[model samples]
Target: MSQAEASQLLGLAGKYRPYPEYKGAGVEWVGDVPEHWRVGRLGSFGYFIAGCGFPHEDQGRQDEIYPFYKVSDTNHVGNEKYLSKADNYVSKDIASKLGARICSAGDYVSQGRGCVAWKQEANSYSGNSDNKCDTHG
Candidate 1:
């Protein structure tokens, strides 16, 4: 993945073209989109569950029963598609006490800021990042 290779890859992506006609998307960042496509807020399509606080000492334990997602877990590359694995874990009781928001079946998760790496899980899970995540149910 050299700079030239990266540039060439991005250049290849630039080959994609939009439909001939376009209209404003309302938001400043999203200037225009295909007229046929309708734009809406991300919150409109799904229920967002904000993360909550949890003691760090209870995290990073492999023996725990429930996975405890933290900011660091986002660093794992393969998990960008789905959160099948986590670097930290917590017990069911601990999670319940922390009131950590759990993702329902088919829910999607992503970081609140920075490079948004959205991923959906096949099953339910919990998080302890304290407002660093946006979980869609």
Candidate 2:
């Protein structure tokens, strides 16, 4: 409800509390990080794995093992901060044939392009989506 309330829940979710101290990170996008946190190049932390392009014809199938998530899936009832629901699914054969990537568990799914990114963890990410649940970890 409030900023303070959100911060309190952060602790229960294994989130680290903000450092009492503060300083500019020198990177415009990064803005301010923990006072003691180190600043590095864009890829210094990790790299982004862009997702494939999924045509409309290739989506909306539910007869598969791998889940195909879209950006909208992030708002799913149970997704919250984790992606456990999807509107589409595809079999291994279909995924492989289309050159889709099946991300491993714990991977952070994010938007392919945007000023602010929505990150979420999903069991598996497969196929190209207009919503673009690209993996970054």
Candidate 3:
């Protein structure tokens, strides 16, 4: 939509005002949102949990393969068309120590820091391998 039309639709030029000087690329309105929309912080919208690094001692032992996910895995899922395989795998014990964050089908995972700009998508573990559940949404 045109800038003027969007502004009118959003009530940005009535009692509300727009900044003539642009500081960034997004549309910034100077008034509250419609009654239906609520404002809140990221913490209020959803829980933020940090991912932990598996210790070197827990690297690989060939006991029970556990899915080990990283930021690159997320990128692999994109454009690959088919299900992407995890490059790393750990033991069940290590996965257990990592605990609750080990991830499961339908869990949302994020790469934590460097790849924060990517969109989050819910993932499902449908592969036969038990070590394929570390997906981020």
TM-score of each: 0.65, 0.65, 0.44
lDDT per residue (tens digit) for residues 59-132 in model 3: 44443455465455544644133223554566555555665254444544443432111111234322222222
The segments of candidate 1 whose C-alpha lies over 4 angstroms from its true place after superposition are 1-13, 27-29, 113-131
Consecutive 10-residue window with the lowest summed lDDT within model 1: 113-122
Overall lDDT per candidate, in order of appearance: 0.59, 0.61, 0.44
The prediction achieving the highest TM-score against the true structure is 1
Question: In model 3, which regions exceed 4 Å deviation?
Answer: 1-38, 55-63, 77-84, 98-100, 113-137
Candidate No. with top lDDT:
2
lDDT-best of 1 and 3: 1
Q: What is the C-alpha lDDT profile of model 1 across 1-137, one tens digit per residue?
A: 53335547778645655468888889876676678986898767867766666565665588766666666665677555556667766666776787766555556666553111223234533343433655667
Better of 1 and 3 by TM-score: 1
List the lowest-lDDT window of 10 residues for candidate 2: 113-122
Which model, 2 or 3, shows the larger lDDT?
A: 2
**What TM value does model 3 have?**
0.44
Candidate 2 lDDT, 1-137, residue by residue in tens: 43346567765433665569777878665566667877777677777666665657868887667776666676778876667787777677766776677776777666653111122335533333345567766
